[model samples]
Target: MTGSPVTTENVDPLAGVRAPGDPACDVYLTGTVFLDIIFTGLDSAPVRGTESWARGMGSSPGGVANMATALARLGLRTSLAAAFGDDKYGEYCWETLERGEGIDLSLSRTVPGWHSPVTVSMAYEGERTMVSHGHEAPVSEALPGPPPARSCVASLRAGAPQEWIAAAARAGSRVFADTGWDDTGAWDLAALPDLAHCEAFLPNAAEAMRYTRTDNPRAAARALTEIVPLAVVTMGAEGAYAADGRTGETAEVPAILVEALDTTGAGDVFVAGFVTGTLAGWPLGDRLALAGLTAALSVQEFGGSLSAPGWDEVAAWWRRVRDLTPADGRLAASLDRYGFLSGLLPEPAHPWPRRRAVPTLGFRALP
Candidate 1:
């Protein structure tokens, strides 16, 4: 069944806006959960009717799983509201996300006799193509109660449940909505009105341009500011463009340079970082830069959820460059760009516990 259309009278995203206050959980993510089988390091896609070889292969939970794991690793208390089948894949995802990543899944459900979603991701350098299949439990069945979070992450798609966004907004939860690829290319403007309840509307460059009917990412982001308070257009490799209607300002951040092996789940990781920074009260530029850095770090490793860097990794990277004395001007400028990380990292005197790589990896680092 289709959800009720969003109207201006019903949604005032700013009406609920207040100073950041303590909440039971940091983020509440609602979406599909897919068991992903990722193949990494392919020189190129397979020819039609031919096979291609991959240097590495790994399995991890996909979809919202990527964002959940990323948020947990960044030290956010995240809760997921989604459906999982009562199958082994579903069990694997549950245990991995909850036990391995420290994400709370109490709101998520395990449906009986339903097949969980699964996807096969083909990774080629910084790009990926995926073939997915599965059954998604209705949103009503997945999250029957009001959201218990300070913020929420949802997807903008056809037939999405608009009521959830409305409920979150009514409860003073900041809503962040991300768009997916629309194969129909309709770029449905009808979806824009639904974002009235969202504090931030995030979409990739192509989606932003197509949705706003603009010629470029900047123009698209500016156009989107008319509908939502903050509009972020993520331009892969080119970084992201952000326009804040509340501030009447626009900022663009360049992407971090890294050796990308697989781009699977990079977008989700970026969202995680962006949301984390937003809740932390950072400036828009710092948020975009951190998001870009998070995405860059994710591409450096294999797997989807498994590849997300934890606080330890981020701190380690910051420690490696904090005292660098670059000899060249351009190198110095590049290092200066990352100076924000130094402030964001945890205190050197107090080490935060790291998430386990897997259930059997053991939690402690070797002495």
Candidate 2:
């Protein structure tokens, strides 16, 4: 089903702190965007030679677009710099982000000959497998530099550092980084030179443990603080934990229980939530809670960018739980933990219609 356009009446979490010279953008990021086609409701992964039919499917912008859309949905002014191919897929993704999600693409460019990258993701039994294809854009298409912003979120690669990360940090932007899997099996902390400039480093349980040589994810978080001021380790179902090297503070929040439909881009949503709370100067525990809450909400839907919840969803969730009688001690504890959202949420209003990814890129208009 088609969804309504995102409402522009979002409550800015940073309204109270704005000043004349503050950056126009709240977050800046540079990366690649992909046209993601996701299939769900599968009983098992695709067999080697057997045909499998999925009960559900959707299409939307993926990769860096996932994070950008997440931030924008949360009311942050997000800026993305990337290369989009001059193809139908590219056109669709551009409009989806620039108009649909209200993300700024001033630093992005359209390559004449390149085609948009594509990924086919299949979800089954709470796990997903993906296959992707695309040619790299020419080095000449790289972003000239990052714009001034309150913060930047970057996906860090082990040995290949983006000069823009350092540039953004030098421009007084607080950088938060998350890393992909280490394909080379090095897991060497020294390989990530860009971590030196980051204000925070977020990695999953496996990545953190491997990089820090620690047996426990929490220990890995503490070990990483020696490299960055703040380290957050995300344990999928267990929730997330954080350690602050500077303040000697730590916080852990349990994951909100939900049946996940598709896990695509859930991690990106988590980072976006954490960045939102940090920019708003919320407490450490509050930041972790917001991150986990947003991620939890995203997994209950399909696709990535489109599944990210806006302020209206957060408010709806708060109201729902508060109005319900505590069915269990866990439910009551969750309410108490997220109580801070009562003041931060916008005034009650009609909930915005949720957006979902579509199976097709185009449809005919009624005559």
Candidate 3:
């Protein structure tokens, strides 16, 4: 990734070439970062005449910014390319993106407004209902060019300039676009022909199925390949499925073992983990395992990015989970080898590393 605090003479993106011997290690993460200023106003689990509730405030991030934050925290070289207003909210998002050790914002653009792109997540019985207002619009700012030579995962602004996605594809960077789950309207998936340039197309079951115009999710996954090279359909508890090309084989990967909380950015978190693992040369099963575990860990917390586990922690957690499940022995050995190379493991444990959080039914964490 381009924004890691660590830089190498061989790894410069401007070189239009990846440093030698780091093929599995090259990546650049770019997208939006925003403020998720939360206000706790709703009851924990509204019941009959449950009018009494508490009030508090928490500030985290929302949208792609939060997802990028999670990726950076996991120690990838990340470049955030979204535009923000030159005001407080934009400033807030900018500072948050730069707050983490491995994130860089040189590619971030600023518009002429005080409002930033943000969402208000209202907690309701451990889940969130968002009331969002974007004071900063995407049209008012300029986005930097897509990275050259390095690999990338675009947040897939369905309505944004298709040129950006195309440029990324032309550059040798693989695309993994994320949608905000809003109706596409005029910005339908059909408009983004650049999706064919992406190595993997990830869409939630509802979104993918809708885009493909089919209720049978497996068929939808297959149909998506007619447009893109490959597709991964994320189904919440049923886990996720993958297929490639027009007639590629599909496989089912089971969900990781974990108690659920709020599955806010579970999809985005899955992309980050899977893409990171793929760049590291992990096999299909391991990539799916990483995605599944990351998504599972994501729901056990309050907000989007903050809920994601760091890479080492996730790898450690994967190891612990691998022991309890009857997974392929090769995956266990491969994870172990990668761990040793990355200095990630000091022996291993059977249970995944667990993170616990208190749940509130109706309140947003302030950003």
Worst 10 residues of 3 by lDDT: 6-15
| Shift in Å, residue 39, candidate 3 | 6.0
Identify the runs in model 3 with alpha carbons over 4 angstroms from their true place: 1-18, 21-26, 29-31, 39-57, 85-89, 110-113, 137-140, 157-161, 180-189, 315-367
- Which rank order by TM-score, best down to worst? 2, 1, 3
Order of candidates by lDDT, top first? Answer: 2, 1, 3
Whole-structure CA lDDT of model 3:
0.63
* Residues forming the 10-long window of minimal summed lDDT in candidate 1: 7-16
Q: Clash pairs of candidate 1?
A: none
Estimate every model's Cα lDDT from 0 to 1.
0.77, 0.90, 0.63
What is every candidate's alpha-carbon RMSD to the true fold? 9.1, 3.8, 7.0
lDDT of 3 by residue, 194-296 (tens): 6767888888788888778888777888888887877888887788888877546677676655565556677778988777666666556567766776787
> Against the hidden true structure, what lDDT does model 2 obtain?
0.90
Say which candidate scores most in TM-score: 2
Q: How many residue pairs clash in all the candidates, one count each?
A: 0, 0, 23
lDDT of 1 by residue, 151-220 (tens): 8988877545567778888888899989788877678867455687899988999988988888999999
Distance (Å) between predicted and true CA of 129, model 2?
Answer: 0.7
TM-score for each of the candidates: 0.85, 0.95, 0.75
